[model samples]
Target: MNALLVITALLAATPITLEETRTQGRKNTQALQAELDVTVAREDQRSARSNLLPQVQLSAGPNLSYQGRRRQVVTIPVTETEVLTREVVSSANTSDSYGASLGLSQVIYNRGLWKQLEQAGVNVDAVRNQSIEEADTSELEAIRRFFTLFLSQATLDVLQATAKRSEEQLERARALFHAGRVGKTEEISAEVNLGNDRINVVQRQSQLVADQVQLAVWLARPGTEALQAVDPGILQQEPAPAPALDDALKQAREHRALLRALQQRVRVAELQRAIVRGDYLPRVGLQAQYAHGNQDLGPFFSEPGFGNTFNGGVTLTWDLFNGFNTDAQSARAQANIRRAELTFAQTARELEAEVRRAHQALDGQIASAKLATTNRAAATQGLMLAEERFRAGAGSTLEVRDAQLKLTQAELVLLQSRIDVEIARYALYRATGTLNPGDSQ
Candidate 1:
């Protein structure tokens, strides 16, 4: 057992990929809540379906009764010729009765119940589709947090490298100052730059810690454990081309879970309207019951001592008037149907707009990433020249520092632009309702 426990602990601490984290988040977070809702909806559908089947009930009980004395006059013939009047009396102290009954009711023709069953089915579909949407949303969130942590870690790497370079520069400046080849100001500037870089390293380290904790919470893990994310190939590959706006809009309409859920809602509302209208028609049902009783508890089921009863019937019920309640309900259902239609239309338009925006943003990020790549190359070349000139004593200290700073900024920009391009692709996927755990790359 101890060995097993150790293995489990080690497994828990293992680094996970982005896809794994997404799956874990779904199991542990709001996605599970959506799954529970789907379960409840399914149960509701089951309950509605049950109304179409026969309902049976069984009952058993005992009863006790007491009766007071009663007197009655009676006529009797005596001595073969004369008639005589006589008094008779009867009384009972207590009587015990035991009874058992079973009854069954079945709906033969209930339009309302049929329509309600249909509505419940529609509701299940809507809830399931909504759950899918929730899962997609959770997956996108997990991706965002994963990449944020990755970016923070990459930034720390840059800061650490820059700090090492600054330290070397400071040492060179100090040597030059001691030999009287450079002024004190040059050494002081190098020292200040090194200190700033060190401070930035600290800040970035703190940010990385915070990001790690946030992701741990999302994955339902211990927040203090150091968690690392494996690259899921999103960063290495070039961003895919965005689809045309018209094609994206079409995909959004056809594949978006939210839109599909809304469409189901419209159908549910229509069914609801039909169900309410059904109240205007008569309902038919069948019922049967069997009952047995005995005054004494013993031999309750005996043929001579027990009483048996059986009853069966077909029933029809109609509501002639109910203070216009049905009319009000029908009107409300109609209004709901109209509201659902409007909402569906509104959601489609909003989704189309979102798709367009995400596509545009992706295009822009791709362009920016390409631009940053070119700038980083140029900055690297400029830094190399600046350092070479400084070593040859042909360039000033300020020129070298400026070139280094520019190169660092360009590197940071390129990293950011790459992350942005990947994020924008994810956004486009989400806008088109295609984001899923399997699409982590």
Candidate 2:
């Protein structure tokens, strides 16, 4: 830290080298790419679990009880017949009971090509694709922020250089005033101008720092090293040819993750309809229950203890008659299928439009970036001339200052144009779903 401070003092407004900042941004983007991959893998696992066999549960419990019974007796009448027989009968008793059991069941059949399972698989793909898209978007944002800070830092560097030149000119003006060749006002004006330039440099440096911090946060960096910025226009690639609108649209339709997810959802919707419609079909499955229990006896019934029970059978169920509800359900299923088909068609059209618009925008932006670069070159030359003319006393300080401002503005414009190109590139990547961490490297 002390070394950096010493260097800053010595350099006093000179542009610092920026090699570390770009590396940090790249690292952060790579991490996000890996994170997205994990997300996709988890979604795949979740889908597999959903497709697995249904789980069975077992339960057991005990019971207790008591009961009462009645008795009946018969006798002969006194006056009627000489001799008659009498009889007596007793009722049954009741008691407590306990039991334990196991049971099993499973899905036997369905129509529509195992639609439920297919739907689950599609959902997994959709979520994974969306994750990739989100990651790409995040990476793009990080790249932009890093570049923004870099450019801001560059601007500060230029301002610092210009401020130093003004300080030198201020010294010269003071010397000229002492020699009675220039007025005191010119000397004071130089000092005042230098102070303003210093302030400008400081403000821009603050902006650059804030931008770097934001970039670091997005990258999930672990520690703080005062991140330096990168030089702009260092072996920048030649602008690539823009694809035709139709071609771009076709590529996007085949690629964009959001579009693909929507396509998957349409399949899922169709599958859901098939699942409900399949309810009308007869289903076959095996079921088995094994139990052990004791029951109490009551009145006419006798008590039994520790009895073993076993049952196994195949079952078939058909909703043959359901107040015509199944017919309505089938119709609804058909309607949902139609709706999904329409949605798919609509999505395709929308995707085409988005791709076409992005292509058009990128073409225009690339041209704009080139023009801005040309302007910056010319302005730089103009500033050089102004500085030389002022040194020889052929031009006023105002001329030098004006040229300096022009050069800075030109630099800013070029920077903005470059940013526009990158943003357009991000747009293209979003449309095509072709953004890879590889692209950053």
TM-score of each: 0.89, 0.75
Return the lDDT, model 1, position 395. Answer: 68
Where is model 1 more than 4 Å wrong at Cα? 1-14, 67-92, 233-235, 304-306, 437-441
lDDT for 251 in candidate 1 is: 69
Expressed as tens digits, the lDDT of each residue in 1-441 for candidate 1 is 322432353356547787787678666568889999999999999999999999999999999888888897989988788989999997657888999999999999999999999999999999988988888887777778888887876777677778878888888888878888778988898899988888887787678778888888877788887676665675566667777888878767767889989999999999998998898999999999999988877768565435989999999999989899999999999999999999999998888889999999999999998898889899999988987886666766688789889989998998888888887888888888777634321
Could you tell me the TM-score of candidate 2? 0.75
lDDT, candidate 2, 1-441, per-residue tens: 322542474355323232343344335655457557757756765665544455455876657655556555666776766656566666666556666678876556645336666766777776666565666666666766767766776666667777877778788777777877667877787787888888887777678667766766776763353455445463276566576776666667666766776777677777777777777788766778887765533411233344778887888888788888767877887787788778778977877777777788889888988888898899889988986776566766677677777877787787677767766866776676565634321
Q: Which residue ranges in model 2 land beyond 4 Å of their true spot? A: 1-55, 66-98, 220-247, 294-306, 330-343, 437-441
Q: What range of 10 consecutive residues in model 2 has the weakest lDDT sum?
A: 296-305
